[model samples]
Target: MINQSELENSKEVGIITDISDKELHLALGLSDPTCNNEISQQDQNESTHDTSNSTAPSEPQLFFQAVGLVRGQYLPSTEKLGSGILLLDDGVIAPTNLLASAVYTVKKHPNLLESPQVWIVYPRVQVKNPPFLNFAIRGARLPLEGEDAEVINQSVDDFSIRGIVTYTNRKAGNFVIKVYRNFMPWKEQEGTKYKPHIFTITGVLPSEGLPCGQFWDLKVKRVADQLVLEDATFITQVFEPKKPKKGRSKRQGQKRKAKRNQSNPQ
Candidate 1:
């Protein structure tokens, strides 16, 4: 299961963009086509049984055939990320076996003109894992001058970046590229552009040395005009909840090895 503890530990935040009520209904298992028929049958059968056999409605139970969707910007709080108002089929505490975060599943529409949508947000506990991380660069200019094409945040795993980027004068193949743990590098990857003061980095967790609860600083050599310079600082943190690891079976491992061999083509 997705680890909520780590998410809670990390001091990161996000805002809810959009929400889809229809998708949420499906997620909550409230949109069953046979729901009405099943309820009718159950009621009829209960009527035939002894009146005493019927479950007493001592406590009132609320039933919702439909739920409303509210979309807005949920600003970040000290403890957790922001969230949208969504009425779920049932009131369920997140961090249960089923849910990875407070919000069930988020559909991202990055470039959409409309406000992004988020399904639900509980009043008490904010989501530990947000859909993405907001990364902003400070005190830096675009298109790093000289041999320093860009400062790439290399990640060995999907959750957080943990790798090395060296500045060398080899004269060939010295360009640094940014990439996620298991994802391919962006085709148009370039150095940090100063246009957008804030940027987003999507990852699940931090590197081994980095603390889970706090942000860590990375001091890199600032480059300008083909000259080595003093240390430039960059910060990194886990944006969202890291996906749970899946154990690989023997057959799957064998298949991976075979695929690797085919690609190498000895």
Candidate 2:
């Protein structure tokens, strides 16, 4: 039951699964995401039948049924601090810390909302202090400094939910959204993925209800002076909410500051 205008043009996260021994481990919320991958790696990352057709064209991006509408959604009003955590599956927490590693390279961004912000390195495994509930990405160009996104489960709706403001720090909290290019995701076969966006927030948790977003536009590389991100930290942003410029109408700056305070009255 999601379509509040496509979860407000989406960034809506929903998908839940947590087997254990057999290693299903892929939660989002409400459960429903289990692919054996036909014995694993979807059969060693399948797809290899070009029949001398010279298959090496590559280069063709654009897709998004729901990578959160190329990752763009906001609600703000939880408390803050990038408050998003949920990750409960451990055989030592491998599969790139939580990516569950099966072989992924999604590239959806042809126009409609643009999904695929870049900056991928799945695998953190520190599970002793900070779990994971800080899923972020908005026009992410890559190079995510400090890195985040852990929680596998604790019932934060299931996992990866959004609608923040829990105090401040969804990477400085507040809001940011962009990248609404529109539609993209092409893969006839290779795990059979065309577009599988799962989202359903009934009571907010896997990040507080709804906000599976991503769409950034940042450029920082200061290094010593600080500020950096070009390859690791879930880099992505596109939260546009800056429109406050309509002054001079308050009786023209109070009648030119009362005619310069009557020509200077100290």
Candidate 3:
């Protein structure tokens, strides 16, 4: 047998004894082994918090963008009652029901040969009963049975029909007037082109388009034996709220990934 000191030296040299975790904890005066678990739990909670507060992507908005004169026209069933045809800017005649409203600004006033004429046609709207065209003009206050003969010519020839209220018979489809100047008031803002005769006729639909079979017969309401202008419609092509776009953005994709990772922690 070896000597005691030799045995002790041999054990110390041959096998290095390390302190156990239990011994280390006891030395450090720690009773709870769950501290590490608590730290891990805190880290997880922080990750979840970051993910919860993250913002997703936003959607785009909808608005109306106007398309030009190629989209204009008179309403349906109002033909054969005019001295001259109301042609488009391209010299093409506007079809019936081209517009969803009756309000037209006279860009080019009519000559004696090419009179300003249109047929009053109404648009179809959603209602229990069909709607009627109630015709009336404004600002005209036509001379009171020969108050002054010159008053008629001046009123008719003026480049501005703003607030001029006149009347037409609701008996026929031919609504006629004559403009003598090619007034483009819209151009007035760009430069002094020509003074425009803007006619603000009422009884037009505020929006566009009409469904099938939604029109009523003409309603005759005369303002001092003058024909009323009603139910005429003009349509325009505009970009409104269309379908939403198809893909997600980079940040949005990252947000989705974060959510997935949160749901299933590694």
Candidate 4:
């Protein structure tokens, strides 16, 4: 008979004597001695793994990273609106919609809007109903005017924008434009296709009506809670032209004639 120590340490015969129930289960290709225990342990491991891998939901973003130039403010008893242009990092200039709290804070510290500064904004969305998004400023700070800022600011002062009129709210007398501007001359690469930088511009509608899908060059100024359109010049109408029906090919025509002759036999 084999010695007890030799049986416990046996390798060739695969005997695992004097081992714990957990080790015995492992040796027998079982996760645990009992099915319930195995399931419970697997569930626990999955729970732990899921908990470790899960992440908290992030807040919505209203604007990309950029510097804001505060141009107008409205402080009323019930509401506040800070209107300005956002100098985006991608060299696009767009309008802003500030929240009441942000407007109040900026009102208290008027200097925050005196010059170009980086603004942090948070987006609020409603669970039910339209116009659910709300953009609120969290804070602002003066930028160092580094190379990036300088490059973005180069086209900020004077530049032409071409955009489509995306939205028009008649009752609200406000509209939104999707503007596209070219990058700085130096930033453009040779031998590569050119792509314009794009951003959205929210402004008040001018006295003249602006139908949707019509392109226009608008003169806007910061006012109240949005940019007010001072004037507008029509550019061109954009629409999907109806495609003409394709004619039948010569082989298809012949096949159709053959089918017709077979059907009528005349």
Best by TM-score: 4
TM-score of 2: 0.18
Candidates sorted by TM-score, descending order? 4, 2, 3, 1
Model 4 stretches with alpha carbons more than 4 Å out: 1-162, 181-210, 240-266
Reference-based TM-score of each model? 0.15, 0.18, 0.15, 0.26
Local error of candidate 3 at residue 69 (angstroms): 25
Model 1: colliding residue pairs: 17-116, 17-117, 18-116, 18-117, 18-118, 19-117, 19-118, 159-204, 159-205
Tens digit per residue, CA lDDT, model 4, 6-51 = 2232121111112333432332233343333223556556755563
Order the candidate numbers by lDDT, best to worst.
4, 3, 1, 2
**Residues 1-266 of candidate 1: C-alpha lDDT, one tens digit per residue:** 22233323323321221213232223223332212323355665765574442222211121111111222322223453322222212322122111243222222322221332222221111224642221211111213355342231221011222211211112121211122111111232344322101112222222343222122222222111011212222333222223233456688899999999999996
Question: What's each prediction's clash count?
Answer: 9, 81, 39, 0
Badly placed stretches (over 4 Å) of model 1 are: 1-209, 212-214, 222-244, 247-266
lDDT of each: 0.25, 0.25, 0.26, 0.41
- Model 1 residue-pair collision total: 9
Candidate 2 per-residue lDDT over residues 51-77, each given as its tens digit: 221122221121111121111221222
In candidate 4, how many Å is residue 120 off?
19
RMSD of 4: 28.1
